[model samples]
Target: MALALSLKVAGLAAAATTILGVAVGFLLARASFPGRNVLDTLLTLPMVLPPTVLGYYLLVLLGRRSALGTWLLEEFGINLIFTWQGAVIAASVVAFPLVFKPARAAFESVDGQLEQAARVLGTSNTAVFFRVTLPLAWRGILAGVLLSFARALGEFGATLMVAGSIPGKTQTLSIAVYEAVQAGQDDVANTLVYIISAVCVAVLLTAGHLAPGRIARR
Candidate 1:
């Protein structure tokens, strides 16, 4: 159950990060405007902040007592706290920088001339992005997404704070390992640890192979 839940949360988080990260990365790479640097720093802040600190912030922003949370609950009948969906949100936020940074770098590394040529040939801006830019940057973006998935899969602190350890619901592999350790179940803890470590190592290896530098060299 823990492994299944972990995979589900990480998959959802990776999907969310891919869409938002790619859009924001493209915007940041192509546009010049005031506060761009500030926005970049804010987007990248999760990478450096303590996980518990991020969890606290998420709780304040998404808890029932908060305005957004209140509106969501009142209008949409949605409550994020102590739920698997909340775990997804927590994992997404924590893993976002893994996607965002690589996405931005990948987009930025794309040759402007190719996009310009597409535009000169009367291709729509959207088409230029799809046909000319995305293909070129996909390797790096995919590498980021893979890393984000691994990060989300192993997320512990923020998910624990927002989603709690609900067995078969919110108890992801990492959280299960924590519980096992706390309960002095050494065998269970070791098993979970080995599973998560193996998965993460596989993801890291794939991401490394698909990295922009390696792709460029290839």
Candidate 2:
């Protein structure tokens, strides 16, 4: 039961990560400032890096020793490292690239000329984005969001390294389920396995429902 709760927390982390990823994707797709490639590469770095490496870097940044960590503890009394929240942050950051790439692809697929036409008709760029581009790109964004959520739900190395499988405290389904399997407690792990399997099916189903053909009105 506690393990299942941890999984729930992890699920929240995935949702938060998808939200952040969508924002980043929007910026990357729409903005054309200098150093754009650098920003794009940075956004994508987490996807390529080993999960362990990304976890390690995050640990250094948010560990009890870091100023931000210390401030979080001092000001908000919030401790991230070794907590469920840390697990969420780790999972989200690692899964971010998955979300951003698809969302970016979706946004880029929109014809700039259509937006320009909207602008010529007295629509502001923001209005053009909201009215013209968003409706067309929503499917891609939804697809990316589903993919990111799935990746976050399955995050193992980063969640383990940062959260340390502390049973009810920090042990998410991915980690506790592993421990159960390793301890020959296959039955215990089975529950989590089924849950993850169900979640995967649900996300894919959602993506299908949100496919461009469905989201777009003829």
Q: What is the TM-score of each candidate against the true structure?
A: 0.99, 0.87
Question: Per-residue lDDT tens digits of candidate 1, residues 111-205?
Answer: 99999999999999999999999999999999999999999999999999999999998899999999999999999999999999999999999
Candidate 2 C-alpha lDDT tens digits along 142-175: 7877777777778889888888888778877788
Worst 10 residues of 1 by lDDT: 209-218
The CA lDDT of each predicted structure is 0.95, 0.82
lDDT of 2 at 177: 82
Predict model 2's lDDT versus the native. Answer: 0.82
Candidate 2 segments whose C-alpha is farther than 4 A from its true place: 2-7, 208-218
At residue 213, candidate 1 shows an lDDT of: 85
Per-residue error for 49 in candidate 2, Å, reads: 1.5
User: Candidate 2: lDDT of 158?
Assistant: 86
- lDDT score of residue 36 within candidate 2: 94
